[model samples]
Target: MAKKVALLQGNEACAHGAVYAGCTFFGGYPITPSTEVAEVMSVELPKIGGAFIQMEDEIAAMASILGGALTGAKAMTATSGPGMSLKQELLGYACIAEIPCVIINVMRGGPSTGMPTGPSQSDVLQARWGTHGDHPAIALAPSSCQEIFSETVRAFNLAEKYRMPVQVVFDEIVGHMRERIEFPEPGELEIIDRTEPTVAPEDYKPYDTQFGDVAPLAAFGSEYRYHVTGLNKAEDGFPTTKAELVDAEQRRQIRKIEDARADIESNEEYQTEDAEVIVLAYGSTARSGRYAVDRLREEGVKAGLFRPITLWPFPEKRVQELAKQTKGIIVPEMNLGQMVLEVERVVARDCAVELIGRVDGEPITPTQIMDKVKEVL
Candidate 1:
């Protein structure tokens, strides 16, 4: 198959990737830096026999997708800063209820709708802990339009495979920036659908172990019918009041990701094996950090980049090794010290962990990252 090349924004590319990944339902509200995702899906979904709904608000948008996923549809929603806040409740619900879904968060400056149109990565910690629970989170960070598309597909795949909510975390710059990209041919990308129970309906359990940590999921309208509650549930997926069942289910919810940490973790290490200073970043910041590291390398500075593609798991082991080997690590991000905290914890007493962060609705330039890299070196 011939691949097509187009100049596309990150949000537009993500919508197309969702469609290609077998997304059959989209429910979203128009929010800055992310509304394009909904607009593109609205125009394209109907053409492909999928449903695109414009909900009244971000909260409703989150609810709609969760409901649609119950019927066995591959469903998703997109949002930015304030909208992400609105969806946190349902996000928790979806997490504990063992529903499979995808969320695209095009981050912007925030506390309260700080910069609707500007670039800022002020949602790193939020994506990890926005929902008030000890539930599982699988979030991916993409740096460019092509990366956004690929990660969006991965978001759906991971969600379906694990039967949990997965997030594609990007910033306002990547969401709106137009770049030329060659899309993968349909046959080039791998698509994963959720597993179904092989047993009869009467013998099925939505949250029970089957093969791996992930349990088989049967769509609600399918021959297999089961009940699930936001409260801690037993293997049968019903609400549980017993301490033993609650403890077992909650531990399993967390262990599913922790045990599979090796498979879920991803990062790109550039010249970090023997560097005096390592610059750490993700999303659009990684783009700037890349140029900074290359220029620093040209100027006789032993600087490298260790970019985390999977943000939730935090890529701690490699970072720990780098901290032990290097003199310092520089973390440059759009928000003030969110992920830097994690770096500090992991690299405690091994090496210095420094951060250059801004939340003023402007992106940190390569020059700025280079300056930090030079200072650290």
Candidate 2:
């Protein structure tokens, strides 16, 4: 029998999603808007035999998740703006080490402790490049409570599949709002677990890519004993200063994602083919953008919406294809023009890319987007 639908806050649903996805360990320091994620996980994870520890600070929380992943557990951590900033170094570590884990950034207004309770999509770029260096990252944004649950599971599955940290990044509005959600059967969703070592103890190489870009992971207590570190290392997992080895390791880490690009991209479209103008928006603000498109269509304006689910490893090719035929592109985000730059850079033609932005910690209302659509039309 199917489970009955339930009303849930997005944060709580996110916590449930992580647990359902088999996340057995969680370490995080709570901050507003996202605090509910931690609070819920603290209660729910333990009941299901999972472990949840509230660390002294965000840095410790970040490192603990990596340690948990190393121990062969599906681990995760959650936080908001200032907390996300503190986790940046460890985030880079997870990227370089190619650890499997989930990091949920329920975004709020920021720079410092800008607006703890208010919503902002300012962290979109941070999720991609806030860490150091050139690396591949998977980030997903959910605009509603149901998607918070759905994307959390997807984030974990992707992290395990690619041996990379995945970000289930959401904005404050979606994180804190309550909505009805209907969950699909557990078996209906495809779950991807990490590839474990198949070689015997002496034959194992922790970072070997000769077999495939995804080198199998070894549990800490496993006989295939090996080391893992943030420093650039060889297949033996030993740090090396050799330039060629350093380059090769970096390329492998990036190529795994870049080559498997097909499985890592997703987006939502509305009335795109027949429209003359298109609006590209994401996160919670996308809701308003979609509404504006509907209103525009009613007013006889040929407009449509494009909402990207995978923010990093962005859908560049699709944007280029759409730019070729549209009269213009409008980007509306919670921040002052973050993703707009990416859109401007990707579109093949010289079409005008307009931005409707807000950083005042308020939702980008449909009225604002409707006005922008009128201006662009």
Candidate 3:
């Protein structure tokens, strides 16, 4: 099978990626910058015998996807900042219920109604803490159209493997930007389905498994019936208020992701082998940071690039390793130093951490990053 190359916007690639990942359902609302994701899904899903729905609002959209997943369908929803904010409570519900679903949260400028068509990476922290409580957050950010496709598939895989929600985040820049994208042939992508209960219907436990941290799922309409709730649930999936029961359930929720820490973390290193300075970045910011590393190299400065493909679970171990080789770390972000603080925490003064940030909806260019590099030196 010859691979096809298409000039696609990031959102379009995301929709295509969902299909390749075996998604049979999409529930979303139309909002600027991210509405294209829904538009593409609406057209694509039906052709493949899947479903597409536009709900009353973001809340209903979020709810619909959860319903779809409970029916044993690969499901997803897409939205921007304000819409994403509306979906938080339900997002928390999906988390507590151990539902496997994908959320596509496109970045936009906002605290509330700030900018509809602007690009901002302010939502990175929100994606980490928006839902509330001490739950695991698995998020992946991609910089290009091709990556948007690949990462969306990876997001679905992670969600199913862990039986929890996973977020594929991109900013306004990548969401609307068009570029060439290459898709792998059919059967080439590594698609994984949720595990089904080996036990009979009478013994199904959605939250508990003797097999591993991730329990087998019993679809709602299947013979295997199980209870699910937003309240902290014990192994049986019913609401519980007992302190020890709640503690055990919460720890299992955290441990499922924490225990799979090796699989959930991803990053890329460029020219760091003999470099004394490293510039850490992600999403669209890394595009410029890539050029900054090259420019510094041409000027005889030993600068390298560190990009996080999976932003959450933070990739702390890798940064800690790099901290031993560098004297300074520079972080460039679209928000005002959100991830820079993360870098500082990991480096722990083993080196200097500098931040170059922008919030005016304008991109922080490569020259700006290079200038920051010089300033730090």
TM-score of 1: 0.98
Which of the two candidates, 2 or 3, achieves a greater lDDT against the reference? 3
lDDT of 1 by residue, 106-210 (tens): 998888878888888889899999999798889999998998888899889989988899999999889999998788887788999999888889999888765
What global local distance difference test value does model 3 have? 0.91
Ten contiguous residues with the weakest lDDT in model 3: 204-213
- Candidate 3, residues 118-209, lDDT tens digits: the string is 88888888878999888888999999999999999999999999999999999988999999988888888899899988898998888775
Q: List runs of model 1 lying over 4 Å from the truth.
A: none
For every model shown, what is its TM-score relative to the native structure?
A: 0.98, 0.98, 0.98
TM-score of 2: 0.98
Residue 168 miss distance in model 1 (angstroms): 0.7
Candidates in order have lDDT scores of 0.91, 0.90, 0.91
Q: Which stretches of candidate 3 lie over 4 Å from their true place?
A: none
Clashing pairs in 3: none
* Candidate 2 Cα misplacement greater than 4 A, ranges: none
Residue 257 lDDT, candidate 1, scale 0-100: 90
- Assess the local accuracy of residue 177 in candidate 1 as a C-alpha lDDT between 0 and 100: 95
Candidate 2 collision pairs: none
